[model samples]
Structures are given as structure tokens and as C-alpha cells.
Target: MPPSPAQIRSLVTAYLDRHPGEHDALAPLTSALDSAGDPTSRTTLPGHVTCSVAVIDRGARVLHVLHRGTGLLLAPGGHVEAADETLLAAALREVEEEAGIPASALVLTADFRDGPIDIDVHDIDASPARAEAAHQHDDFRFVVHLADDAPDLTLQVEEVGGAAWLPFEEVSSPTLRAKLVASGLDGAIRPVKLEQHAAEHPAPAVRTEPAAVAPAGAPSGTVPNIVGVHLYLERDGHVLLGRRHPDAAYAGGSWHTLAGHLEAEAATAGLVREAYEEAGLVIDPADLELVHTVHMVERPGDDPRIGLFFRARRWEGVPEVREPDRCVGWRWWRAEDLPEPIVPYTRVAIEGIQAGRAYSELGWAR
Candidate 1:
């Protein structure tokens, strides 16, 4: 008999659980299956998996072009390993290992691309005979956003020849000088010109005007803005709750749902990180869903706040209070029997749950 959806989901989940690091290895095959459906239509040969970096600055301009020793310039990226199950993971690992920066410090902007060439092969002599030739490589690229305050970098001497930053105006040059221009290095060479311009021009005054208002009839007020990949973490039909530590600055001695503030550096990634930190559980990214965004103005004396909520049912570890100071304890509670002295936003979120409303937009009257 053909497998039911539940059975198929279970089988796929089980397989994924067993090979946690095989997600990237399986992506091409998954894409092929998505497009062609028939397994026989896909290429069966193994290809060398590799990654490239496109590091953009805080102003969204391309920074230094990481180059190989032979003078070929490209972003920082490389081949995947047996331990890397996904292209993103490989890209992050390569960036940190080769660039000497932490994955948390950089933001991934684009998904891995097959790039300009769909197939790249590197042939090597396997033996003295021509028939014994071997081939390696399939190139991929990912865009990365560097922190605004990133420091001057040191090249990984063995893997990289050197790096140079290029300027926007010089990028159009026809000769190799243009490569230097395009890469933004020429700007570094001529700081006096920029200084001269700065000296000649006066700085603009700061604007204190209120932001442009929305047109009449536009939907105004707070809007729900849920993010992706945080969990609801239900067990035995009861959802979990955590009590804030008495010393917590924001919501001391209050009951609240397991949640955390998303990091500015990595918004999407922060959801997964928060789940792990707050609940002491590891969840698959694919298993989480964005449930709602709750926007609200503070009551007379309370602080104004906005919140994004998410829900997930699957995880690998049991829940616990990881930060004893930030979270004193945790318990499972039914939707009907919520604890008292809850944080205001926490109460709003739980009310969203009980009302079967996915989100709420709240506003404060001045």
C-alpha cells in the first residue's frame, strides 16, 4: 500500500533524526524530487560541494573581495565536509574558520545558489594512466552581511592570497585597475580626496520632524508581526510556562511564556537560539511555525512593548530553565488555568491563545 501522509512524515522525520547532518547533502535530491518527482530523472553522481562568500558592509556595499593565490577574486567559501549537513551550515563554518569571525557576528543574506555555472568539475590524475583521472567540485555562493564595526582583517595565508576593499566609483574601469577600483581598494589609497570633499562641505542638520504619517484610511495602530522558528513546546496536552527570576530587570517575579528577545544581528536565527536558551530544548528549524505578532501600548504605568510569537510541537530535548537568574522555574499549564501575576505582554499573548486569535494589535491613547 502507498504510505499515508502521517507514515511518510514519520518516516522522513525518523530518517532526518538519524542523519541530522545530511540535510544539505539531500537538498539537491530534494529539489530534483520537487521538480521532476521521478527519482530516475535525477543525476546520481556525487559532486564536490562548495560555498562562496559575498561579504557586504553595514552600508550594504561590497567590502573586500577574498581572493585565491592565483589572483581569482570571489567571496569566502569552500567545500563541504562529512560533518556539514547543509550548505548554510557549510557556508557559516567556512566563514568562521577561514575568516576568523563568529557565525553569530555575521548575517546570512541569501540562500545558497548554484551560481553562474550549474556544474563545475576539477579533474585530477588518479594514476599514471589517462583512464585513471578523477574529478571534484560543484560551486555554490551565499551572501553575507558583515558587522558595521568589523575590524581590519588578516587573511588566512595558506588558503587566501590577500584581500582588498573596492570603491563604488572605480568599479566601472575597463583594466585590471578597475578590479582594484571595483573591489573598493582604491578608496583606501586616496583618503585625501574624501577628506578634501568633507572639508569643503558642511554636515547636514539632524531632522527632528515626526515620521511621515500614513495616508488616511490606511490600517493604523499596532500590527501583529510574528517571526519564524520559536516553539510552543506542548507536552501531554499542556503548554509550558516559565517564571521570571526576581532580579530580572524587565519582568521580575512574574509568570510568562517561554520567550526571548530576538537579536538584532540575526533575527531569524535568534528565534532558534531563544528557544534553546529559554526552554533548554533543541528543535529542528523546519518544525517551527510563526503563529502571531502581538503589538500593544503599555497601560498607564507599564512599559510599551511589541511581541512576536511562534509555535512548535517537535523538539529533541526536555524543557528546563536554563538561566536560573532570568528564569527561576518552569511548569506545564493548561490553557484554562493560567497562573497569576503574569507579565502584561505575556497575558496578552496567552489571551491570544485562549481566544483562538492568532494575533492582536493594541494601541495606547496619549
Candidate 2:
């Protein structure tokens, strides 16, 4: 049955309540969805809604199709069609079309009959081949269990390389793994809770690199890069991330490591100031560890960014939201349990930390 506008709002609202950690991450997306003149239309610009499903077997194996175009494994789903009556209907239709599974063989839990299993909002890369500009997608994810232990399946050859059922741990791609983790299929999604300034420790050691200089060219004194520092705060079994407020100029509603721009000061000093101002944490120059540096350019016209990502092994004060204007709240997250729609560069840094890499770059011409 098609859901009425009121029902749709109720379903989405309850889904967000179950996942408070994503409240900050999905704040603006939800706001736009709720306030739209003609909500649920796929043609909406800047962002749109898509539906996908995580297909699992009785043995807890997940189904994945290797996308031929991008050569990566992804779930079965697509944009909402105008004829679609509801989000669940759209997700089920994609599964049936992409997996060639009979409707009777898919087990839709009654718990999810009214709500999605998870929600992911990610930025879309703008490419000339596809007409989409720089926009985002609020992907509603549902879970379907296979009734039959073994079922006959066919592939959408034009889009998929092959399809397989494997344990969640066996998923090889980092992006795919992160999405699976976010979907809560393996029970890794962490709940949202801000740890107030509870306890304090001595400041950590610090080291920082100098700001990048302009290249040798026609004229002088030009600042070619924006210098920023991101602190990787670690506690007993989790790391800290702040959710950018919905009213911020950029990255509003995305979870990011503690970071701020360098303002006429050394990166080390700037980081210290930002730590106190943003998270109410104090540190010494000696406890900081240089884990990685990211040289990234968001677009051709935007200034390049030289970011120093530090690992703060120890610091004084429990994580807190000292600056309400910048970020609304803070939460401790496991690497395997990070929420969706994180700042893309910050996600790269977290992955680098797990893989023991020292540095990386993004959005640069190869």
C-alpha cells in the first residue's frame, strides 16, 4: 500500500529516533525532505531519496553485486520511480529486479514493515557522463532475509559483474565494508551519546608541520593553501567525533574529527586552541602523534587544503561541545562502527589509521 504523507513523516521520524547518532549527520537532509513542497520527488535538486536493501541468508550471508561500471560491490537499489507508492515498495522492486528472486522467497520482517533498517546520505560525484551535478542522496536501507537456504538467481548483466553471498567479514572493499557496518547488519552501529567534560588528564605531546607556501610563479605573497588540523581523540574503546551543526556554512550535519583552520599561528598552537574551543580538551605539545596528512582539493576553483591529522593519545577533559555554533554534539565511535555521511576526507584518514598508512591525497588529478 502506498503511504500517505503523514505516514511517511511518521516512519521517517521514528527511524531517526532509533538512530540518534545520525541525527546530527542527517539533520539538514531530513529537514529538506520534510520541508519540500512536493516531497518524495526524485527530480529534487541538491539532494534526492533512493532506496536499497541488504539481502541476507538464513546463515547471515549478505548478497552483493559487483558493479561493472565502477568495478565495486554494491547493494541492489536505484532512485525512486514516479510510479512508486512507498519507500519499501521501491526497495523491494529493486531487489526483485536486480536479484531475480521471487517475492515469496524474501522475508520482510514485520518490524521493518513501517521503517527502514538504516539511512545513509552521501555526496555524489559530478561527472560529465552523467547529468547529475554535485548533489547528495539520502539512501533508505532495508533488510530482507532469504526464506530458502538456496535459491535460483539471475543477474542484471548490464550493470553487474557477478553476484555472490558471503559473510560480512569477507567483504573486501573498504567502502563496502564501511557501508555494511553502518547498516547494522553485523551489529556495529554505535548509538549517539555525548560525553560531557567528565574527567581530565595531562595534555599530550604535540608536533605539527608548517603551512604550505605558494608556488614559484608570476607574483608574490599568495596563500595557496588553507592549513587545518584534525585531532583523533581516543578513549577506552572508542574515538571522538563532533557533529557539525545544521546552520554551519559547510558540512552541516556530518560527523568529523576535531578540526579548525590555522589562524596566523603554528599548526600545533592552532590545534591546541581549537581543541579547547571546540571540544574543551586541553593538551601539551609532547603527547600528540602525527598519524597522517591529507593534501586534498575539493574542486578546481577552491583553494587546496593541507591538513595535519593528529592522534591525541591523551588529553584533559571529557569530550564536550564547547562551541555550540560550530558543532551541536560529540560522541565516541568505534572505527568499525562509524555513522554514515561522515566527512569524506575524515573517513579517509580513519581508514588510513587502521591500515597504518602515513599520508594520502584526494580530489587531485591523477
Best by lDDT: 2
Q: Which tens-of-lDDT digit does each residue in 1-366 have in candidate 2?
A: 223344456567888777777678777666775673444555576777787777767566778888787777777777776545567667767776777765445544323432577777788778667765777887777666665432587887888779888776775434345555565554221111111111110011000111122334525555445567889877775778988866454576888898877645666777788898777899985778889898898777455677788887678988887767557899999987888779898889888887899999999999
Question: Which ten-residue region of model 2 has the weakest summed lDDT?
Answer: 198-207
RMSD of each: 16.0, 21.1
Over 4 Å off, model 2: 1-5, 170-366
Q: lDDT (CA) for every model shown?
A: 0.47, 0.66
Clashes of each: 11, 11
Output the TM-score of candidate 2.
Answer: 0.46
RMSD of 1: 16.0
- Candidate 1 C-alpha lDDT tens digits along 57-97: 54434434445543655456665553442344555566666
TM-score of each: 0.37, 0.46
